[model samples]
Target chain A: SQKIEQNSEALNIQEGKTATLTCNYTNYSPAYLQWYRQDPGRGPVFLLLIRENEKEKRKERLKVTFDTTLKQSLFHITASQPADSATYLCALDILMDTGRRALTFGSGTRLQVQP
Target chain B: EPEVTQTPSHQVTQMGQEVILRCVPISNHLYFYWYRQILGQKVEFLVSFYNNEISEKSEIFDDQFSVERPDGSNFTLKIRSTKLEDSAMYFCASRYSPQSSYNEQFFGPGTRLTVL
Candidate 1:
């Protein structure tokens, strides 16, 4: 069985500071890793996706890094703002034993950017 | 930009009743999926549909659940007998492709199903 863990507590920080969220997994070999942003009462929006071959990926102010050797992925929001306050989820492509299928998921970490 | 859309933003149904959640995925997208999030729980995958058939489904998707693309525009999930435990926010998502390319799924606002 595989376990994905993220900081369950809400991350509080002053606006404009960098917010780093960690996602660690165990007992599974993922084909790819992804990060998503979910606001209350809304569906998660895709933020970034990084493959095992790639060490890091970036889009605008958001960045994601995947280290398969460590079975971990970290999502970073630099120059964070109040608007960036939301729950962030890190999902991995869980391939079944057949190795042709995958699913997306993560427990999610709550983030609160204080003004 | 096109987005996935779901109807009946909120639905409350009695236990054992049948409920159908509807979604209209992005027109050009080929892969469609359903996921649910119980309050205070992680978002869990329900099923994935591609090319008019189920590609993969999670263990949580039991016999009580079924999916349909009744028409060209609508993708639906029908619960034959809704249980109280089924109460959760159901999200509908779609992706353009899943064949080793830039496969990203676009999600809808979700329909909150409350089974009482």
Candidate 2:
């Protein structure tokens, strides 16, 4: 079975500091890896998606690095603010032999930015 | 900016009762999906609908569960007999295309279902 793990259940960091979260997976070679932000009582919002060949992707204050060889991906939120506090999830896109695609999500890492 | 929308922000139903969750995906999106998240658990995929048929479904979506896109704009998930374990947040998502470069799924606010 394919498994995706976001190791840290929760992380607390001071405002303006960089918060790095980790995602690791096994038993599958995904075509794309994605990150999403989910607030309590709300659905997840799409953040970024990096292809297998892409090493790193950046959008504003967020940066995500994918290392296929290590079967790990790192999510970084730089100069974080209190508003950036939320549960961040990493998902891998699996393309089945039937030509269908599905996203398998990690347990997610909750980040709390303290002021 | 377009977004997926779900009805009834919260639903409370008795065990063994039937419940229908409705969603209106982004107008132009071709791919629709249903996902559920139990309290403190990861989001789990239920089913994916495309071209007016089920493209894929997870094991959790058992015989008691069914999906329908009765109308062009409305997608629905129905649970024939809700169980206590069915209590969770149901989310609807849509994507414009399946192409890797344009496949970011946009999720709805989600409907909290409480089965007692």
- TM-scores, all candidates, are 0.97, 0.97
Q: In candidate 1, how many Å is residue A35 off?
A: 0.4
- The interface RMSD values of the models, given in order, are 1.5, 0.8
| Alpha-carbon local distance difference test for all models | 0.90, 0.94
Model 1, B1-116: lDDT tens digits are 89999999999999999999999999988888999999888899998898899888988899999999988989999999999999999999998875668567789999999999
Clashing pairs in 1: none
**Which 10 residues in a row give candidate 2 chain B its minimum summed lDDT?**
B95-104
Give the per-residue lDDT of model 2 (tens digit) for B59-88.
899999999999989999999999999999
Q: What's the DockQ of model 2? A: 0.84
Task: Return the lDDT, model 2, position B63.
Answer: 96
